[model samples]
Target: MSDFFNNKRVWITGASSGIGEALAHAFASQGAHLVLSARNEDALGKVAVKCKELGAGMVSVLRLDLSDHDSIPGIVRNMIASVGKVDILINNGGISQRSLALNTSLDVDKKLMEVNYFGTLAVTKAVLPGMITHQLGHIVTVTSLTGKFGTPYRSAYAASKHALHGFFDSLRAELGDTRIKITLVCPGFIRTNVSINALTGSGDKLGTMDEATDKGMSPERLAYKILAAIERGDEEVYIGGKEVLGVYLKRFFPGYFSRLIRKARVR
Candidate 1:
């Protein structure tokens, strides 16, 4: 465990399960004060209990639905009041899409953007004021390899992740010399329930886990690496197996990368 996160006040969204839940446990082990959020209050409470058991200085659970923009302000206010000031904000909440572009409706795309892009932005903005006032903060976003390279049947989800890179990159530049750090984590795949919970074009759950994800990195290991990256103040990190090559290929050999990615079995 890195001493960089010791005693820091951290907030993690989507903490009910999967990567977010794993991260909550890992951070708590390092003695962080945690504010965990998710749509399921019961699950959040369970996570908080585990976090406390893992040695967190303090654990608070707040039920949050990121897609509901109207409720963000109050949630932010409550967090500020309870935590006093957040040292790190992990924008880990978002949904994935598993539908073909042709079959995807505009409404589906809108919903994806609302939760994955706008929702992340909303939460970051809500906490940024306090960070700026204190002159220090860290914003870590969990994007995907799909954000860097396009994949079949995930157009909307990919677009949302790509947008995160653009937004956070600009934000890092804008906050230069302000002690506010932004780290964009692009993970290829992680063994989690993301695929099962992913939304399809018709707004139904995909309900089946993808093979690649089932064999990918474990959330616990990924959480450890992410915390290490944050400690080193890295601007970006790509965590995955060979899938990370796609990023370099796309940059140096766009045509070759495109053809190869098209043939790859992302699902």
Candidate 2:
């Protein structure tokens, strides 16, 4: 029950399941107006119903496919018209990778960048105008531990997440002292379908869950942490267990970090 989110219009992509779905419920409980989006319209509708049940101010289901860049602008326009305006945007829609770089096809790499990098960029640009017009907004991106440091099986996925960090960091510098805030959430393994949905070298789903991922933090717990960071206007926040230390380890002890990462069971 956060007063800050009361009646606030919050738009979340990939809201059909996993972390995105948890975020919707978390925001709803705080009385926020919810705009849920994903490729699966039926799934989004189901999430919308749950949001309404959770005491959301208002809930709207909007179909969104990140891969379809041309349709993003129109969807954003309609979302604003219907939900009034997006006060807070959760950039949570993204794909993951789980294949060695050498085995991975170039096409597979390109698709990873297309959805995770270009698709994210497209949505942010489309929403920026409205946030600017309102003179207030928050952009929360759900990057991963890979964004800070790379792993063996997630070459292109790491690249895409790394690209997000670069873009958002520059955007924050450009904004300077503005009411609009940006927060990059770099989470370690979370209990989600991300592993099963991860892309392989051939561009097919991994279709299996990693052991560490199975024992990782819950989405409900991470959602609350994200909400707290947004309220505080934090530029960046890392949420996870020991794996999060890799970000710092890479920075201060590159050689040691490299050896550890190589031996780590990323999959």
Candidate 3:
């Protein structure tokens, strides 16, 4: 473990499961003070116990609901008051979608944006002032491969992630030499319950796993990469398998990529 994270206070949203739970373990193993938040307080408790067992400096579990944007600031304020200033913030709480644009409802699209884009923005803003005051902070947002390029059945999900790119990119530029660093971590896919929890056209849970997600990289491996990226103070990093190629393919070969994407068997 790098000494860089030994005493750092890291706050992770969606820390109850999947990538979030994996990250909690990684940070704990590095001896960082952790604030883990998710809607599932029960699950968060389980993760907190394991983090403590892994030798976390201190572990605190707080329930968080991303879709409830109005409650974020107060929750963050309480967190800071209880745990001191946050040194690292991992914005990992988000839901995915698995319906085509035509089949997806407006409410579902709004909900995706509500949680993925707006909720994340709210949390970032809530922490921004504190980080600026301390003059020390690193924010790592875990977006998806779809954030860079669109794919079938993920129109809203892609849009929400794309919004993060736009907002954070501009913020990074606007920060202008501030110590506050923004690292956008784009992951192709990491094996998790994301697919099963994904929303369908009617806003109901898909409750089924995608074949690609079933065979994707492990969350532990991605957590390691994310840890390194944060330590290195990277502005942007992409982690995953060959699907990472889709970003460049779309960027440099729009026509060809469009044709290729049409044949993509994405659920």
Candidate whose lDDT is highest: 3
lDDT of 1 by residue, 1-267 (tens): 447778999999999999999999999999999999989999899999999999999899888888998899889998898789999999999889888899998999999999999999989999999999999999999999888878998999999999999999999999998999999999888999999999999999999999989999999999989999889999999998888999999999999988898887667
Q: For model 2, what is the error of residue 63's alpha carbon versus the real structure, in angstroms, after optimal superposition?
A: 0.6
RMSD of each: 0.9, 1.0, 0.8
- Model 1 segments more than 4 A misplaced: none
Greater lDDT among 1 and 3 belongs to 3
**Alpha-carbon TM-score of each model against the true structure:** 0.98, 0.98, 0.98
User: Candidate 1 overall Cα lDDT vs. reference?
Assistant: 0.92
**lDDT scores in order:** 0.92, 0.92, 0.94
> For residues 113-178, could you state the per-residue lDDT of candidate 3 as single tens digits?
999999999999999999999988998999988889999999999999999999999999988689
Determine the backbone clash count of candidate 1.
Answer: 0
Could you tell me which residue pairs clash in candidate 1? none
How many angstroms is residue 86 displaced in model 1 relative to the true structure, after the best TM-score fit? 0.6
lDDT of 3: 0.94
Q: How many backbone clashes does candidate 3 have?
A: 0
Candidate 3 Cα outliers beyond 4 Å, as residue runs: none
TM-score pick, better of 2 and 3: 3
